[model samples]
Target: MSTLAYGCMGLGGGWDNNPVTRENINQAHQVVDTALEVGINLFDHADIYTLGKAEKAFGNVLAERPELREKMIIQSKCGIRFADNEGPKRYDFSAQWVSRSVDNILERLQTEYLDIFMLHRPDPLMELDEIADTLSVLKSSGKVRHFGVSNMNQHQISYLQSALDTPIVVNQIEISLAKLDWLEEGIMTGNADGRDINFTAGSLEYCRKKGIQLQSWGSLSQGLFSGRDVSHHPQHIQQTAELVRELAYKYNVASEAIVLAWLMRHPAKIQPVIGSTHLDRIKACAQAPLVTLSREDWYNLYASSRGQEMP
Candidate 1:
């Protein structure tokens, strides 16, 4: 898998009930072409993205150019359901739902097997034994080659892994310059201020220790540190944007590369899922691996974003 992945969240049109149009399919083709051109082979998707139209749009691209499938590592997630007659919007981990959702995801993507099938989120009502059995069946049937989880804490992942024969290979979570909880969780340890951080303690270390790939979801921070407007934003955000611009010029790479390089600098080897659909932004993001931030520069950017000196 590449250190960077092209996210398909923005591939399909809107999140409405509208069907996938030719325009959507063409856009998917362009995205795929650019990602591949820039050496991004992994593509990320979720069943609920754009109401499943995202997968449908990519499926159209694959159906027309079957050869491209061989050049990609396709992964998708499930377990999130929207509100309907069944019940209010909730996470479902029942055997029936997992099996049915996998089938639908495969059908929409027009693929034989997913490189990695992730559980979108934890279901409060999930039965460990039952869910493990369901995933075991999927693996036996060759529908899913590997399994992973998203938005799960270290305890949740360890508990789930204990019940399964296969290892949980990836843990996707929100990690970016804008979201500093993951980093602050470590720095603020043994301090009262750490109590307010939302990220689960030891989550990052657990993944690194267990050899589980840590994939970042909101890795770009919505271009907050890149080129997005920040006039109304906090002082730290505006300052971080200016620092990112300086580093981009110093390293001779795009602003996107500087922003992502901050996350890549961590020893965890995080795989950032770049969610941009624009060709220029995609290319800019692919330049991240080319520029590695030194420890001093990395700390400068971190402190600038946090708007405080490290304790």
Candidate 2:
């Protein structure tokens, strides 16, 4: 399985109304170079990221270095539209939107076809048949090689997959030491207190059993021990940071490696989508694959993160 994926959300900095420029493109190239140096070959993008400048900056890299295209797996997502004066921010899974989004993504990424394409989020108003047909057309036309979804639950993925011949290969969701809901839902299962766990029941297990790739966002938990003052952090975060630091010292690696190793220790073979733009941070995160947490240490970190013992 792929060890990790680089997220382009932070590329082409500044989400203000400003348009992406050559400066952003240069910045993206630097980050991409650093990520490649760290052996991360998968790049993740969303149309709404940095107002679409993320893709443009990344595309600019490929335009300048066409050879880089074959060395990487580029994936992007669409269907999230901003709120205008007309209405609130919403999702669009309409056939027209999916078709047009793929075209725009290819143009911005300076690529002929995407290795994978995913819906940015679940579209409650989705017409499954229409979406299935749209995806069929895109796949048959050689626009997208594979399909996936982000922030979708098991039932939603099942329903969508049922209507399409192409399989949903990945499901990206927020998972980290700081975010315990994903694991808490299962750890607390069979107990009445588990009712409050809002994560979709059996979602993690479903993905694991179906061989669906589980890619995590916020995999580093926003830098638990990145020289920040943990005193001001929440009690649970403070505790988790302390434990991570201790484990890092014990394992002779950076704290990021400890956190990511905890997630990687799971049986699901999760591929974390790391968004760090700092070269040093990327290098530190690359050490994640080297750390092997024992079963006892892994649960200790989990209990520390959740501020309680596992059920």
Candidate 3:
């Protein structure tokens, strides 16, 4: 239950046209070192990042700094399989797959157990009872301490929880000023023009009421806040920049900090999973917990995203 979860995606040795090398590993070490210096107690990972290269890369660093292991919480996700590089993707939630995945994670992370283990994404065909049974076994064996899901909706969460004895601790999703559908309606709410489709409804409020923590992936909007044209959608880009600037000035921090703070400001007590390859950006995200935003500011940004004032 770290206040902020620092993502290790970029550090897993890819993105930004940066080749994964010894220098990259050294930079990752530096990033982790900086995160430690700033009191970032949680490190977030996924089994599929960099095609399973991320965990091994992080393992190298952890092996070197064995002493730092006690000071941090490591969480990794499983269940998504990228057998084909082009991605006719598959998901495996069977007990056997879950057990094998945990074994691989432990070996790659160079750790005995994970503080939190999550299903990377909800499998449409998954059997809740089967998945839950696997989690039970893992918990009993000390392979995973807590259980949760990523990219899941309320119904999906409920389906899994219904058959499981373990408490679903958190739901990690894409939530940002740019992606606010979960706040307005459920994830099933979609726009007619085949655009502006939302998938989760009042997800923030739901998690709050249920005592389920919310973790945000793509906290920087997939580098959208970095002033890059991720989609070439002019309006989206304009709105993101404007909101980032306004909030930055109000908070007296970097634009990225405002974005992170907005998610952190929610009542759900969100822990943003920052995916930055640069050490400096990672350090800036570590400062997010310190930025406090007023209710009005949070709503103002929300309105900007919607392009209308709240009723």
- Candidate models: Cα lDDT each: 0.95, 0.89, 0.79
Global Cα RMSD, each model: 0.7, 1.3, 3.5
Q: Which portions of model 3 miss their true places by more than 4 Å? A: 15-20, 84-87, 186-197, 229-236
Q: Worst ten-residue run, lDDT, model 1?
A: 192-201
Worst 10 residues of 2 by lDDT: 221-230
The sequence of per-residue lDDT tens digits that candidate 3 reaches over residues 168-283 is 88889988767877666642345343245566555566678788888988778876765566466667457767777777877777777888888888777888888777678777
Candidates' TM-scores?
A: 0.99, 0.97, 0.88
Ranking by TM-score: 1, 2, 3
lDDT by residue (tens digit), candidate 1, 1-311: 88899999998899999999999999999999999999999999999999999999999999999999999999999999999998999999999999999999999999999999999999999999999999999999999999999999999999999999999999999999989999999999999978999999999999999999999999999989888999999998899899999999999999999988899999999999999999999999999999889999999999998899998
For model 2, how does the per-residue alpha-carbon lDDT over 115-192 read when each residue is reduced to its tens digit?
999998998899989999999999999999999999999999999999989789999999998888899888777889
User: Between the candidate structures 1 and 2, which one is better when assessed by lDDT?
Assistant: 1
Candidate 1 or 3, higher TM-score? 1
Q: How far out, in Å, is residue 157 in model 2?
A: 0.7
Q: What is the lDDT of candidate 2?
A: 0.89
Error of 1 at 190 (Å): 0.7
Which residue ranges in model 1 land beyond 4 Å of their true spot?
none
